[model samples]
Target: MRRRTYLAGGASVLAGIAVSGLVSRPPSNERLLEAAREPSGTGEGSSNTETILSGTDHETSLYELDAPNDGPTAMVFGGVHGDERNGIEAAREISDWHPDAGTLVVVPETNRVAVENDDRRGVDGNLNRQFPADRGPQSELAAGIWDAVESYQPDVVLDLHRSLGIYGLHQEFVGQAIFHSPDAHGERLADRLNEDAVPWYLPFHRFTPGESTLSGPLLFQHAARELGASAYIFETTEFLLDHSTMVEMSRLAAAHVLELHGLLELGGDA
Candidate 1:
């Protein structure tokens, strides 16, 4: 498969700014705790369930953890690129998790074929590029993932991945950062994640539609615009954080987002 060129220019500028640290410095531990201290939400509480979503040639698992309180639904997926080990680990961990409130849907592996093969592109093509299908038919795997996303009608969606290089440091990489759609909800969450402690923290980076046009149809953007769900793409740097650290950071990021959305109670106060 050929590399996409749409994001070439915009990514350069974003990287430059991020490397310069002009945006904001990493927050201190106390500051992080203070900034993180927001009112938590309450939940009705329920058990966890797992469902296997199957398509023509691919099958992935979906875990649903329902809270006693009827709240928003959150969808988190990983392994769309197969080789992104960090996201896959995080997604799998989230699958077994029980949220404090609201509904949590975890798709640990979006591209089962690609993941099994440890390849970026599946047998059909890049699963990430096949989303929100415009003209041609969607790959079987992409279609299956889309069906699950649509059926759940999530209030927010988080797509996790691991980038090859660190953002700002590597011109071609978008790692160690949060790539968000135009939706304000997702953007706000990205901002919050930006303030996290070092190593696990990520800077907020917004890619304009024109910049990402050739990157393929983005499911996150589609979910935000079409389904009215706050969506984001969380990319961790494989260079800076080890696989385990990356997974831990991904979990922290997801928990923060859930808290911000009031989907889960942050502390016992709620």
Candidate 2:
């Protein structure tokens, strides 16, 4: 389903106050949306693309969207597992969007080899599991991705994926869920999606927010632990929903996170 667009007003007075260093408070969703819709006075919201792991088998494009205003930075990833095409598509779409405030860094196909082969992992094993908590990334590909993360120093990190079944229904699968770090706003994102994007007839498909397992060597977990960034892993189920719905769900999750971090506006339409 196509998302509904919201017509926003002028930039909020709250944003002006915050910019002037007169008050410190979280901007309301409406205010953020308004601010994001406003034109950046500076011609700085330009986008650039670069190659990650250049001249290597795992090479992929990395897109960076810099807004005219200075704000928090967000890094988004997809294609960690090749079979998860929804996330890959959503990330690719997001790569072309323009952020209104902070920078947006996107790696649409993190594991290019796996994506090409339609497999879960590349020859070096699961790319998602290569980032151990105590040490540097174990594989060359993982290390290159990690290097980008370190260089950007993003305030938020979002990893998108797909699962074969619902998170609670399937013992090993974690879909229709947002696994988040302690500092992340997973619950809020879940609530927003459930209220707007989810269909009433499919109550079972509603998004859930859960605390991420720190025991695993997941990229989101590693970023949260090491950089203290708000990190999340958004998963959509493939059991009942069609491919398009899954892509929409992943897109909504990423857009909402960007909105929550004041990087974008009207996430429902983003």
Candidate 3:
């Protein structure tokens, strides 16, 4: 079927816009704990079940929706930046979401500190850059986040992020998409997402080489180095305050992913 035909209905809604990320002040130790354990887990543990996925007193939530069978495993990340609500919303859609094959390990809010403060930067004002699994975090708090992601070991990672809106465009960048150079795995992942079509700003999304930044595909691509994990960074534009737009954008992204996995039938209700 034609690509657009493939994306007809809700999936095509992904073709709506573009978005982007980081910032912050030193977060209190207790606050970090709260941010870590904020979101609920996959099953009926509580509104805070996703919190347990982070371990003892961990603040950020990791909502994983899957069974421990065989097949491939996927990691769909949302909310690298707290202000980037679209990614968080998208990951939530994926959490209650289930698929036939493989596994889905989701960390809706990778950076809890930012999520709580509604700030983009981490405690140290640095982006939560230690991804693609290096050592653990230098600080006790961030180290906890690093540990969770490293352990999950998702096969394919989709890091959800958003752009800065108009000012971002003036940078000659309406929207940017991350793909690994010479890495077919990353390229293919990007193809899977673009196939669903999104409300990208430019005529087409900008495909950049993953050699810079401590976040997004750069980190995921780096992590792929050791784990052989295929990672791609997805950037959508952001205005925030527009809660409805955020909700719909996340819904479309989730629907697009469901289409990729052939589980649109499951619906978000899963």
Candidate 4:
């Protein structure tokens, strides 16, 4: 089934018809600045690399940090929409945290052009929509971002975003809710997070499958099916939670995912 939903003000829709049978190839001239096969630390090691997307001047910083012991890898993406500063800030803060067991990869600003200009759609259109594709003439920025996601090969993925409307107030918008793919993986995480007092949640909903709408491309949806990993696109209502509170919630959400996979240990442990 396919559904097309709009964002705040009905300006953009998150509906992207799921694309099938598309072959994905890295953009030409895509190069990683790092030389190591794997990051260099045994425990709590971290490394930052710069990715230069061949044709554009846009540059993205990639961060990788491993825990003290072995565990699953979780990937976090922020700033898919340049105007959502909360998710971007949340992502940037998480990159500094040291996990206890697994690997954490973070791209704080996925759409640098949009983020830099505080625009929702970057120069190359919506970055989130142009993914899992076989071609270019597409945004070089989107192509570059896709290359990074595919190369990282995460066990789970999270794309962070912000919504202007409250879910309860605006039935059409995904505000104050977890807009996830159809999967138990995301449901489980959402259930746990919603248990908090004055919880920043409405209900769990699925994105329109197959193709791009106002909402752009569903990144986690493709990642979940193609990569065989649990994935979600988390949205926070801008008015529901204050900036600091939103950041805290984002941190908690990431921690919950890591803890669920045994990659992180919080508080005093059970």
Candidate 5:
């Protein structure tokens, strides 16, 4: 495979301003659409699908997009919690994304049973909590998902979710936040979403970055700890925002993370 440079010019510019406290103007909607439609590398890439947890009721399709050139791999999971419709839609859209020089692995609905039943936890319990720290996955569905993740060995892992309220405002909710591993660019991802995707009127909908807790048995935490991947859990608020906006925010978050990890390269400057 052809090894391509990790960070493109636009991506590097965004990273620079994200750290220096200088804000870059948001890209226009047209530009964002164009970027989304364009292929990342020299030519169109190939794609394939596989079934995880085969022969089981929880089985779901895993979509992979491979670039013509070699770059870091990114894995995105959605619908871990069935009620988070925005994340599931966003992941379905991201499944069609063409990388500039990397591999993109997307599991749009990890817990198929939960998604089908429209419940938070599948029959086996909360799939997110099944991957205990320093231990094997606690459920068969979790094990199957983990097996797929291990086989891919993604360099970056993004799990999409939604909550009923904002993180700071609601005691039990963690929405509009990015929980990330130390090595990941969670702050940058937050900045990007706040600048581009969020509207000026919705000041309360801004995103913030928080360090992922080691005590949690979450899938992202497990990936960060065991695979040494730059893992992130992106949460949006389903209360304030409409369903369309929620999906857009989720899509933007995923795209920005992919760009940060060199799995994508949007055209134009930051």
Candidate 6:
């Protein structure tokens, strides 16, 4: 059954809805400059060559690092929202990085327009919202990328994003970090995953999926599986950060993910 909901003002929200407009933070011009240069490709070893998703503005692109492996693949998609810096950063690290002997697909920014124009969605549309089947302007941009994802058939899909500065009611922001929404599955520790030093919720309750949001990891989690893929979301601390720090956190998560897949050089990379 399909349900439609609006973006909630507070943290606590229910699931199953079509959220319109941008979620929370939109990208600023300064943020867009982080990767002003044209995206290039790199696939050393058994990996395949990298490529960029070119927009009207060539510089505003999604650089994908495709490593060759026929086994169950892992897709690391970052920067679907221009304002969300952590995923993009992680994508960059993985591109240059060679993890294990398997296929790894890294898309630094699914929404290139958001990154380039420093906007949530691109000039034409919001890539994440547009995914799964976006024909473009007349329809949705979501199709292009999500289609790739479906065809890739990644066993796991890790999407990087931020927790919309929600606190108390929905989440809590501690200094640089912000806790994210729990999965529909009731995995408590899963909420605080990949963190260097953090504890699971002191109290647990029935998970309340955030604002039946438009499109994102939430949508992917439910939608992707139907296409032969599992999905996960990695939330970064709310707010903008220095490019370097963003890159580092992404690397940490990527390392953890690789380790989880047992592709980090056979054993013990985490």
In candidate 6, the residue pairs with backbone N, CA or C atoms under 3 Å apart (3 or more residues apart, or in different chains) clash, namely 4-18, 130-142, 131-142, 134-140, 134-143, 167-171
- In model 5, the runs with Cα more than 4 Å from the true position are 1-33
Candidate 6: where is the Cα deviation over 4 Å? Answer: 1-44, 50-70, 131-140, 166-219, 239-247, 266-269
Tens-digit lDDT track of model 5 for 117-209: 889999988899998886899999999999999999999999999987678866678889999999999888888788887666557678989
Query: What is the Cα-based TM-score of model 4?
Result: 0.71
How does model 4 fare in lDDT? 0.61
Model 1, poorest ten-residue lDDT window? 205-214
* TM-score, one value per model: 0.73, 0.83, 0.61, 0.71, 0.87, 0.58
Q: Model 3: what TM-score?
A: 0.61
- Model 6, residue 30: distance off in Å is 31
- What tens digits encode model 4's per-residue C-alpha lDDT throughout 118-210? 999988777777754333325677667767768878887888887765555455656546655454255566655555313322233211121
Q: Candidates' lDDT values, in order?
A: 0.64, 0.80, 0.50, 0.61, 0.82, 0.46
lDDT value for model 2:
0.80
Evaluated against the true structure, the overall lDDT of model 1 is 0.64
- Residue 8 C-alpha lDDT in model 1: 51
- Candidate 6 has an lDDT of 0.46
Give candidate 5's whole-model lDDT: 0.82
Clashes in predicted model 5? 1
Deviation in Å, model 4, residue 22 alpha carbon: 43
Q: Is candidate 2 or candidate 3 better by TM-score?
A: 2
Query: Which sequence of candidate numbers ranks them by lDDT, best first?
Result: 5, 2, 1, 4, 3, 6
**Candidate 4 regions with alpha-carbon error over 4 angstroms:** 1-43, 52-55, 132-137, 181-184, 197-216, 267-270
Candidate 2 per-residue lDDT over residues 122-208, each given as its tens digit: 979999999998789999999999999999998999999998766775567788899999878988999987865666555766889
Which digits, one per residue and each the tens of the lDDT, describe model 3 over residues 185-225? 44444443343333334334433334333344244555566
* Pairs that collide, model 5: 41-100
